[model samples]
Target: MTYRMLALSIDGTLLRSNSRLSRQTKDAIEYVKEKGVYITLATERPFPAAKKIAKALKLDNVLITHDGGFIASDVDEPLLSRKLHEDKTFHIAEILENYKCHIRLLHEQFSIGNKVRQKNQLIARMTLGIQDPLYYPVTFVDSICEHLMENPVAPPKIQAQFFSAEEAQAASMELQKEVPSIDTIVRGERLEIVPKGISKARGVQVVANHLGISLEQVVAIGAGVNDIDMITQAGLGVAMGNSPEELKASADWITRSNDMHGVAYMVKEVFRKQLKVNI
Candidate 1:
């Protein structure tokens, strides 16, 4: 089968356990690009966070970020964007405060989050890779709900980190019940909320159309439950070995864990005849 496009999920799929890219992975991507394959990142992160990884990979192609709610390579110009209106944002924030979860709103370039400093409070997944103060400035507010009440923010999505998975699950359920039009994705103790119909599947389809390719020519690799849609929609879907059994069950193949450089292993295996295993 000839694949024209390769879509990768960040975090556990593209990066290692320590949140770093490997030399082997870089070489594999270069090999595939030389093979005339297009590469892009499909992630739940905002553009700034995902763009940092793209810079490491040296890929300037359009990226699918914010769980498919936003897509663009350059910050100023966006090929596509889907964000929650301010009213919905405020309502979601109101619901989240009940659980005492650390909440953050994800914009295309900037970030607004609550100043959560307490025991067992999640630090928003190691700050969620937004370290560039000049490029991706993050604001830590005292109360996100109050901030929204005073000012409106149109964000692609919102993320909440809980102290326990049970709390996360409960929050997800309540949010879904209250806002039936929204979508909730639970990863361990983190709960990611996005507007309805916004998904990686939508992102992939948009990128495919932008690249003028068919879905059958795309290979999706992911490790998170939020990634299920794209993984299921692609011609070839792969799950990392460290992923949950349910996520693995959705994949057409299972590769090594993130620590073992699963993406490099899988890519090399697929194009072994054309690309060498060793860098």
Candidate 2:
């Protein structure tokens, strides 16, 4: 198939385990762009965190950030953005407060969180290490739910980090039952909540439509459960070697793990082959 675009997940797909980009991956991306293949990042990260990587890669396409809740480039207005209702945001925060978790409410440009819990401070530190954008802004309130109740503004996404994946899953199940109007995805020790029917796949579809391409002409590569929809929805779906077994089961192909320069290998082995045939 003559693929026109590549949608990549940031955390475990493009970055190495240390959360840094490798020269091999950067060179591969440049090669693909030179060949006229569009590249964009599909991540659960907010725009400020994701934009830094996009700019480093020099990708000009509209980015699918906030787990597909926000789509835009550095220059253009968001093509699509799905924000949670004010009531739902507060209710979700209320439910999460029962657990030992660090909660964050994400907006297009800034995020708000309450005082970090002692137990979950490690999770917060880990997240800080990974999402280390120089200019990403965050505010700390005393009570996230109460603050949102008083302020009453819709947010693009709500995220919670737990000490264990089990706690994250338990909270996710409860959110699903109590808050059916939102979509909850448990990725490792973190749980991400967004408006119903919003996902990376949906975000990629919006970008495809804007580019006048069909789903069958797009390629998606990811290493997380949040990426499953786009992996299955894209014309070609690739899972990284470090991806969980479930994601690997759903992938059309499995490349090397992110640390091993899997993305570059996939581009040279899979995408390059197709491009060569087309030529």
> Could you tell me how far off, in angstroms, the CA of residue 184 lies in candidate 1 after the best superposition?
1.1
> What is the TM-score of each predicted model, taking all chains together?
0.89, 0.89
User: Which lDDT value does model 1 have at 254?
Assistant: 96
Model 1 residue runs over 4 Å out of place are: 117-135, 273-279
- Candidate no. 2 TM-score: 0.89
How accurate locally, in lDDT, is each candidate? 0.84, 0.84
The digit string of per-residue lDDT tens for model 1 on 1-279 reads: 778889999978888888788898898888887877889999887898889889988899999998999999898889998888888899999999888667888888788877666676644433533222235777888889889888899898999888799999999999999876789988778889998999988999999998788898789999888778798999899899888888899999999998898988998887666432111
Residue 77 displacement (Å), model 2:
1.2
| Candidate 2 residue lDDT tens string, 153-227 | 688898888879999999999999998788888878988899998888998899988888888888899998778
Name the lDDT value of residue 113 in candidate 1.
78
Clash number by candidate, in order = 0, 0
Which sections of candidate 2 miss by over 4 Å? Answer: 117-129, 132-134, 273-279
- Deviation from native of the Cα of residue 177 in model 2, angstroms: 2.4
